[model samples]
Target: MLKRHHKTEALILKASPYGEGHTIVTALTSGGAQLKAMAYGSRKLTSRIGGHLSPLTRVELALYKSRDMDIIKQAQNLESFLELKNSLSRMTKAFFVMELIEGFSNTGVGNRPLFDLSLMSLRGLQSSSNRDIEDLTVSCFQLNLLKVTGFMPELYTCVECRSSLNSNNYNFIIDIGGLCCTKCLSGHPGRAINISSKSVEILRQFDKGGTLFSELPLGSTVELRRLLDSSTGFWLDREIRSRRFMEHMNSRDIREPMSAIDMESV
Candidate 1:
């Protein structure tokens, strides 16, 4: 049974201009489905809905069911994540998170845990002030995102033989989605990347729900980033676009700096 009217709490994933002054919004609903709806005249200066439809905003939406797309009749913002928006570095990471969410997520699927995890990750980003902690937040979010989406990498047992992993073996096979033992590495050939024991321990800690960034070595953090980023790209079969901007911003190596408008869009 379909209802004519619908209401839901959603996070605005993206919004684009539509015909005339309207807007096409893509939102991740609280019920865990990706929803697309039209907001008539939302792009106009006088439209009240325009302000609440920006990407990364959490809002309550009132929609009317239509044949092609749902129509947004009303919208009220719930969470603006103002602190996150105020910092450029945090905003870049947040955008990266959103991009990955869209890449791994599918429309019309019941994945409430994914929605909850997404919200939690954003909130975690909002509260953190340290750069190390911020980086850790995004990394932890990615790891949890993988787990929620059923792509969690096996950290303990050998992916090939399902045997207990030995202390000296720390090979993570990106294609196979887990660790490969020394013997299994021979089977996997060049497919395995040799991970340091420190990196492995860090990943294990994340897998076990540890978030404290204190005493975490920078090298290990970078190693984890490379591994997780590669795995995410491999699984999604495409490079995450926002990752480039995030890297650029972090390096602060702007020989060719982005314009103010360009920076704001990111």
Candidate 2:
């Protein structure tokens, strides 16, 4: 009997050129599994899948089971977030978000919450007001991703003694997954990142599902960024390339002049 496989709708998370004229596409299916397949002749100018299979494009695809790799028979475009492509900042942020998802997600894991969060993050990136909002969205996504994946850090209490955290300064142990009160900090050799009260409050808001892209307190944003970056870096065991790109953009933001009107308004 011939083997059988079912078709599914997926969003292309990453894609790269393969062999001579083909392309390898990695996507997150609507069913919440990562799917990898090859789109033959995709590099050719006349290929129908040329523009449709690019990263971040939602597509409906037909797949056939094969011993080595799955075969992509047909592809139809569902939703193309064109705005992300139009602006460099938006594009970079979106790519970074996708990279995080791809890096953390498993091939056959069916996580509906993470899947929904990814889509929501993409939509926020597409329509974000400015770079600040984009940064906050990314931070929020990172926090939520860790939460859904069962890696959410114990931020409210000390990771060591389980005591309530009321300290002005915190020692965040990435491997242990949250703040270590001063007492705990002294015992461990983990890298520590400071956390301010305002930052802790902001994290609490995120834990409570506050609005994405809201006006963030600058201090809070900075602290949250540091916490997430440090935590993710330690847990993932390597630097994420997209994060370096984000840092580059942030540095540029620092050099840009702020309008008097903006300052007065804030």
Candidate 3:
């Protein structure tokens, strides 16, 4: 028995060619569940759904439930992030963010905070000045993702003894999802990353949503990159290819400074 479903709003995260003239669209519905559907003839030049099915485009799609895959009958674009698509850096960052959402968000789960954070991250990337700001935006998104997924690290206290963290530098254990003071670090065998006091302060700010990318310091930025990488990698148990690309992009940006005009533009 086949079930016919009407239209629903969705944000396209990934779309790839399925067959000769069709495409497979993977989207995150407003209800916070992942939806995969086949768009017939979407790859053709004359196809009306050509531009509307691109990643990050919000759309209303009509789908029919099939045994293995859902079939998309029609799609109408709700919002196209034109600004993000126009710039190469912005596009790459946006894709990375989408990849994170696609990889972490579970099917049939309703997480409004994750959805809202993803949308905000996209908008931030679109308007961000340089790679620095872009990295901060992604870092923030990753932190929020962990929080929404119920894996937020215990920053204010030791993961083992549950003692309040002081001004001393600590070793962050990715597997434990928090910090380990000098005593705990000696006892545990997990990989440890050094975190400075300033970095901890910045992380606290991130948790509170006080100041964002522009207000973050260089050291804090570096610490955040390390923390997010190790933490997410440990929990996910695999490397995210998009994150590698983002690292490459960040390195490239560091090799060249933005022009005075470019800096002024942001």
- RMSD to native for every prediction? 2.2, 6.3, 5.2
Each prediction's total of clashing residue pairs, residues at least 3 apart in sequence or on different chains, is 0, 0, 0
Per-model TM against the reference: 0.94, 0.89, 0.88
Query: Where is the poorest 10-residue window by lDDT in model 3?
Result: 257-266
Identify the superior model by lDDT, candidate 1 or candidate 2: 1
Angstrom error of the Cα, residue 259, model 1: value is 1.9
Off by over 4 Å in 1: 253-261
Maximum-lDDT candidate: 1
C-alpha-based local distance difference test score of model 2: 0.80
The TM-score that candidate 1 achieves is 0.94
User: Scored by CA lDDT, what does every candidate get?
Assistant: 0.87, 0.80, 0.80
**Ranking by lDDT, best first?**
1, 2, 3
Clashes of 1: 0
What are the per-residue Cα lDDT tens digits for candidate 2 across 1-266?
Answer: 86657688888998878999998898888776777888888889988777788898988888787876787878899989998767767777788888878877778787778788888998988899888888888899989988887889988889889997766676677787888888788777647777778777777788999876477678778878888977766667778887776566557654455457433332
Candidate ordering by TM-score (highest first): 1, 2, 3
In model 1, where is the ten-residue run with the lowest total lDDT? Answer: 253-262
